[model samples]
Target: MTKIIFKEHDGKEHPVDVENGMTVMEAAIKNMIPGIDADCGGACACATCHVYVDPAWVDKVGKPESMEEDMLDFAFDVRENSRLSCQIKVTDALDGLIVTTPEKQF
Candidate 1:
């Protein structure tokens, strides 16, 4: 399992142990991390699970794929660090990944 830190808009943080290969959104939902609406259930068809990858971990987490980038066009307050949690798969290299939710999902 990989450990991921999810920070809510209000600055609350939730640390979760997620199985390898599972999408970050799945872990958030399972752990009841607030701010991850996951309206499309990790389908990459919606942006409700939008998050800002911690700048320090951006290189490790990598950028969003084209499909995710397209969907992110609909997210709120998108920035250089913006990403759809559903598109980020867990891996041993990603242990201790950190992501922060937007003030609201779109």
Candidate 2:
């Protein structure tokens, strides 16, 4: 399992154990982390699962695809490290992944 740290805008942090092959959004929602709404599940149709990957882990998390990039544009407080959690698949290599929740998700 990978240890994913979800940091909220309010500075609250939620650490969750995510299984390999699961998407970051799925892990957050399953663990009841208060950030990613995942309104469209993991279909990549919604921007509610938007998150800012920790700068230190940016290279490790890699870049999002064109479709994910388009969805991120509609998210709030998007930054250089912005990513759609639903598009990020978990793996052993990303065991200590850290992601930050956006301030808003509408």
Candidate 3:
């Protein structure tokens, strides 16, 4: 399992162990982590799962592709590091990955 840490806008931290092949959004939902509504499931059709990848892991997490980039336009407070959690696959390389949730999902 790869451990990932999610930091909420309020500064709350939720660390979870996610299985390989699972998306960050899946881990958040499974662990009941607040701030990730994931209304579109993992389809990348919505931005409810938007998150800011911590600078330390940004290169590893990479940038959102066309579909995800388009959906991010609807996310609140989008930033250069903003990413749809559903687009991030969990792998050993992502262990200790950190991401921050926006104040609201909108």
User: What do the candidate models score in CA lDDT, each in turn?
Assistant: 0.94, 0.92, 0.95
Better of 2 and 3 by TM-score: 3
Query: Could you tell me which 10 consecutive residues in candidate 3 have the lowest summed lDDT?
Result: 61-70
lDDT of 2 at 72: 82
Minimum summed lDDT over a 10-residue window in model 2 is located at 69-78
Task: Please give, for residues 3-101, the per-residue lDDT of candidate 2 as tens digits.
Answer: 999999988999899999999999999998897899999998989999999999999999989999888878888889999999999999899898999
Q: Quote the lDDT for 70 in model 1.
A: 94
My TM-score estimates for the predictions, one after another, are 0.97, 0.97, 0.98
Clashes of each: 0, 0, 0
Candidates 1 and 3 compared by lDDT, better number: 3
Query: What are the C-alpha RMSDs, in order, of all predicted structures?
Result: 0.7, 0.7, 0.5
**Which candidate has the top score in lDDT?**
3
Per-residue lDDT of model 3, residues 1-106, tens digit only: 8999999999899999999999999999999989999999999999999999999999999878999999999999999999999999999999999999999999
Q: In model 1, which range of ten residues has the least summed lDDT?
A: 61-70
**Model 2 misplacement above 4 A:** none
| lDDT score, candidate 1 | 0.94
Pick by TM-score: which candidate is best? Answer: 3
Clashing pairs in 1: none
